[model samples]
Every structure is written in C-alpha cells, then in structure tokens.
Target: MLVYGDIETVQTVKEKQAAVAALLESVRAMPPGIARHGTLVTLFIGASELVQGVVDAGFHERGFDTLAPDQEAGMACLVRLAQEVDRSWRSGFASAPPPTGALSGLRAFNPDQIIRTRQAEGYAFYALYPESYLEAARSSGLGPDTRVIGIRSIGMSLSALVAAALGAPVPFTLRPVGHPFEREVRVDPALTHRLTSGKSGAFAVVDEGPGLSGSSFGAVADWLEEAGIPRERIYFFPSHGAPLGPQASDRHRERWRCAPRHLVPFEDLLLGPSDSEGLAAWTASLLGPLEAPLEELSGGAWRARAYADEAQWPPANIQQERRKFLARAGGAAWLVRFAGLGESGERKLAMGRKLHEAGFTPEARALCHGFLVERWHDARRLDRVPVDGGHLVERVGAYLGFRAGHFPAEEQQGASLQALRHMATYNTGQALGDEAAAALTTSLKDAEALEAKVRRVWTDNRMHAWEWLVLDGHLLKTDALDHNAAHDLVGCQDIAWDVAGAIVELDLPEEATSRLCELVQQHSGYPVHLDLLRFLLPCYLAFQMGACHMAAGALGEGNEAVRLRRAAERYRHLLRQPGIRQEQEEAPAG
Candidate 1:
C-alpha cells in the first residue's frame, strides 16, 4: 500500500528532475512478483506542473493507482493494508534490474546503505536520518508506536530519514503535498520491502516553519487523513519562532478549529498575543501549582507635575519651598533624583528636604513615586498633552491657579519690575536729542497733566467700561505670548499689571498703545483694575519725561540740566503712586 502527498520542493529544478529519475529506477528494480502484483499508488499533491510530471513519470500506470489525500483514516490504502497485514513485514526481496540507468547513474539507491556510508565518513548520519524517517511515518500513518526498521534513501529525504530512524517502513514512494523534492525521491528497495511487508505501519510527518500558513496546515490535514492516523491522534506543532500578529493569530485559530477532529493543533509556547487574556488564563492552568501575579505598571501624571515645576527659575533660598510644592503636587522621589539640575548640590538637597516635609499620605506618595519611576525608566512612554497651545494655556491656568488658588506672588513682582525698567530705557534712549524741544518742554511745565487725567477718570468712574474692553482684548490675544508662561501670567494679577506697566513705560508710540489696548479689550472680557492702573502710570511717566527732555534741549546748557533733573524727579514720583506700589508689593519675585 503506497500512501503519499506531494509538496512543493525547496530545491532547484535540476534536483527535482534528479529525484524523478531516481524514483523511476527504484520502481523498476522491485521484485518481479511484487512489482507485477503490487498496487503502486501516487497522490498528486503540489502544483499542476509537478503533478503532471509525477503522472508522466508513470508511477500511476500499470499496477499503480491514484487518490486524493483525504482526512479519513479508513479511506487511506496504506491504513487498510496495515490492518490486513497485522504484523511486521519481511525485507530482502529480490527485485528486477533498473529500467533506465538513472538510479545507477545518479547513485540513488538504498538509503540504509547511504546512512552507513555517510557514517563511515565521520558524519552524524544516524542523528540526521531519524527526522526524515519520522516525517515519513507521520505521513504514512505510523505514529510513536510504529516500529520502522532499516529504511534507506538514495538522496536526503527528511521523511525517509525519520522512517529509517524509527525502523518503520519507508514506502516505495511517499509524496508529501507542498514538498516537490521529497515527492520525487526514490526510497531504497530494501527499505520499501520492509515497510510493505507489513512489519511496521504506514505514517506521515509534516514540518511546520516560519512560512507555514493556512494552506500548509490544510495540506497536513489531508495527509493525516490519507495516512490512516486517527485525526485526533495527529498533532500539528507550529515552530517556536513563528510570530503571531493579531491578524495572523485570528486566521490560524479559525483554520485550526476547521481541521478534522483527529488532527490536534499545538502552538509553540513562546508565540502568542502579549496582552491576551485567554493566554493568561491558559498559562495559569499550565503552571499547575505555582504562579506569580502579573502586576500592572504605573502611568504618567506625576511626571507631568515634575516637568511643570522644573520649567520655572527657582528662588535663592526657595529650594525647600519648591520641593514642598512638588510634594504636594504628587512628586515622586525619583523625580528629585533625576532632575537635570546644574552642578550645585544645593538644589538637589533642597528638593529632597521639601519632599520629606510635605504631608502626602503614604499611599498617595507611593502612587506618585511609582509613576515617577516608571516615567523615569521609560521617558518616551509619557502621554502627550491633548489641548492646542492657546487652549492649553487657559486650561492649565484654570487648573493650577484659578480653580486651585495656588498662584505664586513673588516671581510675578520681580519679572514685572524688570520688564518695566527695560521698557523705560528703550523708550527714553530712542529720543536723546530732538528739535521739537521748546514746545515739548513747555508741555512739561504743566506738571498736573497726568494727575489731572487720573483724577478725572477716578471721579467719573465711567472710564472703567473702556478699561474693561481693553482687558478683554488682551485676554483674546494671550496666545501671542508663550503658552506655558502666559498661563502663569494670567493666574497672577500682579504679573498682568507688571506687563501692562512695561508696555506703557516704554513710551511706545500712541498707535502701538492703542493697538495693545484694543487687543486686550477684545480678549480679557472684564477690566482688570491693577492692569489699567499700571498702564496709566507708565504712560503718564513717559509723557512727562519726553516733555522734560525736549524742554532741556531747548533751554541752553544750564537750563537743559535743570529740566533733565526735573524729568527724573517726575519719573520717580510716577513710580511711587499708590496703585503702582500695591502692584509691585503683590507681584511674585522669581
């Protein structure tokens, strides 16, 4: 009984032709009695060209027969023969001479002899031969229980070698679907005789590797049926390194279930979905007695807080204070350790002390620490901010200050004052000398010009509407500044006042001032009292200084000096206004 399936051989075209030639020679050499009476069967297993080539090779003519590889064990001819014989078959039958010299020319004969020859030449022939024979056994319906003996082949046949190793019968011709080269090879007549004599049962084996796919598995299913191995007894073991992508896993599982009941599917232990709940359950079952918990790792919130705080410039002695702030904000200890501070050890120590002092509950602190460590170890894993730049600034401001009421005051004061000084120098330096001196100088003589304006607005109180409109405009255009800094500025009124004051103090052209006021009014929604006051003071000071400087140039040398001194006095006086003093005191120092 010949049972076989064809496979596309992974060999060159010339090697395939050689296999066909070798197979023809082996068939011709069979014993005259058996050759004439025996039913030679061939299963066309691969592509059309190879199948046609096999038929043309004449294995199906004369006493040869053909069948489609199927899944029912009883349907296979090899299985029927094994049942009929019910015992070990004998070897050493005399066979006729070769039809063509192809077998002799190619020296393709007696795989058992080849194994011995190869072994004598110092090769591990015994070890290499078993896998081939085992493949044959699996393909022919012989399983672990089948006793294969003295199997041999002319060339390397993984299936033939396995059969030889197992002392199982090597069929005269075993065709494995999808393996073209193996399909075409000739088995040793002695090995074939031993297998056919019913000493050992028919078997078949399928090699599963990286490129094995749905179709390959299907072919194996068919072979198992033809080999007479009960479908449930046949197992398909996937290679260890095969990667199981989500899509591939789904496809493979579907196909495996669809296969015959007798064919069992075994997956390599290493390959599976990383986050698969099913896999986790399966692993727990396999562990039998002991299993460790699979813990979920921490996420990124704490890291965000650490980054936010680090962006600001620290105060001279505020390291402790900053650390306390961070701790309250859920900072982790690792954050302090990994913070990219300059060489000064002071900053690090201060941060540590602050964290220690902060009164975070142990659980909260632990959670925060876990988050920090996770983020520190895998920095790229941080979640990205979802809001756009403009919206983010507003949202952050609301979160940290407006909603939480956690604004810092000292930094705002320092930043605002410095901005004002810079603006003053920029505005004054632009007009050191000018010929409109006399008229401007005379304007300064009216020292009440600025005070008069302020008193008028205060008395009327109607100007508040215009001020509110200007603040609104500023709010709308807040996106014009850096988002992170703008959020900090918006949360602190003192910062807003300082920025407004800087704009006014610069003595920027009237058009620029108008534009700034218009923008603020469009965005801010309501008038900010401190900001308006700060803006008014600078405008008043700039006007007074400009008038005095112009007056000084017009007055000849001595009077010019006096006018300049007066301008300086007026500038200082403007700076000392009640509103300005309050704003400065309230502003945060960096």
Candidate 2:
C-alpha cells in the first residue's frame, strides 16, 4: 500500500528546523528495521537552499536518495522499500514507469487502507499564519494516520483554529511554548444555569467601579446572554445612595422596576449599607410578595421559602448544585438555599438557622463564604508592598454624596488646578527639607475638595474621568498627592503636567524613543492640540515600542534592570497621555 503524507513548511526557518527535529526524534525512537527503512520526503517548494539542506540531512542520516520530479515549484518524493531489501518489491521497482503526473499521483494508494492494513503511514505539520494554507490542506483532505500539528502564537483565535483542525476542544496555556498545545476549560451552560438559578443562585458577579465599564460590561453581558439568561432579565444594581424619606433615590429604582423582579440591593449590592435593617427591609420590599417564607440565618445567610413545591426542586440534584456552586464561586462567599422536606406536609422553616443545621440554605451560606473568599482573593491579587526607595506617588479623590450636577467647565478647570498645587508641594518636599515635606503633607488634604469639584463638573457635563484625562492629558493627581520624597523626585509627572513633559522625562531606551517619534510623525495631524500632542505623542510611541523591545530582551540575564528602567520610562510616558482622548473634538452645538 502507498501512503501519502502532507506537511506545511512556512517561509520561517525556525519552523523548518522544528519540523526536521520532530522528524529526527520520531525516526530515532522507531524500531531498527522501521528506522532504517523509513525514507524522508518533501513537497519541495522553490526554496533551493532549504530543499538541499533536507536532501543532505537525509543522505547523511539514512543513506536515502532524494529525487525531485521536474514539474512544478513544489514536488513530492516517493519513499518505498528497496528491491535489494524486500524481494516482493523487485519486479514493481524495475517495471515502474517514469513519473509523469501531478503531485496527486502520490496519493494513488488509499491512505486509510494503508494505515489499517499496516502497510505505510504519514505525519504532517501545518504552518501558523495566513490561515489560507491550512484551508488548502483541509480542502485536499486528511488521512487516517495524518495528525496535524499547529505551530503559532498562543491567542484565543489561534486556540480555536487549532481545536477546529484537530476536531477537539480549545486549549489554554499560562505561558507560550514553541508550538505547544493544551486543552481549554469548557464551561457548561446548562450546568451553570441550573446552579445559578432558583432560590439559591449562582451568579458570575463582576464589580463595575469607575474603571470597569464599556467593553468589560458588554463582554460580561454578552457572555451571560450566551449562557441563556434573557437580556431583559439581567440587572445592574447601582450602589449610589437613595434619597432620604419621601424623595428617595428613585434613579436605580426606576431602572429596576422595568426588569423582572429579582432583588439585588441598590446600595447593599455594590456599596455595603450603613443601616443593615433598613437595607434588608428595602430589599424585601423590592422582592415583593414572598413566594416562600424568608428564612434568615446567621452570618447574613437567608433562604426564601420554596417558590415552588418541594417535589419540584429535583431532590437528587442537590449535591450537583453544591459542587457547581463551589466551582462558580471559586471560594467567594455565597448563600445557597434548598426547600425543606417534611412528613406529608411541608416543614415549618424558621429564619436564621444555626451554622450547623442540616437544612441551612446553601445560597446564603455561599454568599457569606464568597465574601470572605473574594476579600482574600482580592488581597492576594493586589499583594501591595511598600518598596524602600520606590518612586511612586499616591493621590485620593472624593465627591459629594448628593448634588452630582452643578459645577460648570470653569469650576472643573479650577478643580484641576488644585492638582498643580499638590504636585508643586510634593516636588518641593523632594527638593527641600523635612519642614517642607510636613507642609506638603498638609497641602495634600485639599485633594478631597479638588475631587468634589471635579466630580461636580464632570457630572454636570456628562463626562467621566477618562474623558477628562483625555482632554487634559494627565490623570487627576489625587491618587498621587500623598507620596514620600523619593516619589516626589523621580515619579512620573503629576496631573499638573502636560503629556509633552511626561514624554520628555520618560526613561525609555533609544530604539523605543525613535519608534515613538516615528508613530507620532505618521499619525499626528490637524485639530490635535500641538502642545499637548507634542508632549504626549513621544511618550505613547516610546511606551508601545519599549514594551516589545523589553519583552524581546527579557530572556537575557544581567541586563534586566536597564531594560526594566527603559520599560518603566516608556510606561510613564504612555500613562501621561491622560486618558484615551478623541483625535478631534466636535464643534460646539448650535
């Protein structure tokens, strides 16, 4: 039987080397007879040097002759047993006619028949980029022994492509290995839904503070929708304070009223409530008529009486639900609830059962557990430490609890000016003595006032800090105000400075600086503030270029600190761009 094997060799020399190495390893491990008999062949593309190398390697290692059919740029070599070694092939070898056909002639014998009959087999490696190459191979069809290996960058898209090629699952890797493949974790939608739904629920909770908006929310919402929840059923619980007494904060209330009545406390859900009783009462009222009696347990665990009959709760599935909840919770505190069974009639369930009770609501318990777990997780993720001689600045901002609107553009500008004051004081501390540092510390107190002003201004203008940063070209320096002398000296510019200043002060290497200059030159144009652009463009350029450059050099030891400093400088420059500002501003509305 004849076996036809196909492999993709990209223009990249690295891929060729890898393929050769894999082939050698395979041959080396094979039994002596098979190894000595195996012949290496290639669909020789028009790279003469590469073809010659392969030919030379084959001749030296296995004493096999290489032949190229004089037809097209890519030719196939036939490898079979020699007549001298196998008497059965003597007549066939002597009588074989001169090869006069397309490369398809190589597949004259059925691949499946060969593999199944234990005659001949083949293996292939596919190239990574320009996916068209893989498509070509697939269109031609794959043989039974033909295992396809994908060699490329580790990205979500690449992972999906590789999985599709192998007819297997997606893969995940914490770090990239040259042409390495691994399976990805599969999320079961039905299982997730079964776990999160009903009285005791599992939710993929995401916190949306100021930083997490736009794409993040959309991504989560899309994922949830795909997971089977109706778009209309998803709720966003705003944690802003409600108005006191009669004129309560109806903002969130109005929004929630339209959605299916699922209760997440407007305040308690996002921002913990000061008055626990009032918050609980508010939540209960929001939930409306109790489909089941509310069973409050210790540690803020609670279960609503069964909304449906206990018989409908799928009795045997309780354990499955608990396991699923644990996985979803990932150790986050949570609460779980299940209906209680009694003799004939339903058992009388009381609120706030003891921790050890057999009938305790898992949802409520999970919630409590999840909170603690999340706290520890967050702490671990942050792992903030004070580094001696570190050049970092800290700033703080505050806003009025009420009266979000009222400040105008002028007031907003004035609020930003406060940052300059703090920055100046901070710098003075670095330049002067202990007396100055103490004075600067006092000046930092104005940050709250500045924050309030900024908040009012932004709220009135329907703006966010991101927008403000884009316009001004710096972070509001509130977070950086209360820093030590080391930070005051070497820290990237405070909010008071323009982007240009930051770029100039950045610590990037020469190449990164040049690359940034090139990018700015290519893209910067009319309507962009010249001074702001001039100041900021280099920083952005430097940062983008520097990161790639640093990554390239990271494997080398001894020179890491220099590279790190370069990377940091680039980062500082990029961060100084304020926020992602629009390329052009709209004309004033008529």
Can you write out model 1's per-residue Cα lDDT over 1-590, one digit (the tens) per residue?
00111111233334444444544544455554222212111110111123223322333232232321221111222232222111111121133332353223222222222111111100111111112222334444445454322111111122223334344443223323335222222333454443335433433433333132434444444444444445555343332223432223454456456532221121212113442322232223322221333222112223343235422211111101112111111232222111111111222233223323431101111211101111111121111222233432332222112211222332321223333333333334444323322333432333333222211100100111111111211211110111112101111233234334333333334334334333333333222233334443543354345444544443436533464556555554553332333323222211
In the order shown, the candidates' Cα RMSDs to the true structure are: 34.8, 29.4
TM-score of each: 0.20, 0.17
How far out, in Å, is residue 145 in model 1?
A: 5.4
- lDDT by residue for model 2 over 1-590, one digit each (tens)? 00011122223333443443444344334443311222111111111223223333333343322222211121121111111112211232233222223223222322222111010001111111212222322343332222221111112222222223323322221111111121122223453454335442222211111011222223333444566656554432111122212222343234334532211332223123432332122223323332332223221111112212322221111101111111122324222222211100011111122111322111122111011111101111001222111121110011110111111123312223244344434333433445754654553444445343221111111111211111122122111111111101111221212223323333333333333333322322211123333322332333333332433333333333344445444433453333333343321121
What does the lDDT come to for candidate 2?
Answer: 0.25
The prediction achieving the highest lDDT against the true structure is: 1
State, as a TM-score between 0 and 1, how close model 2 is to the true structure: 0.17
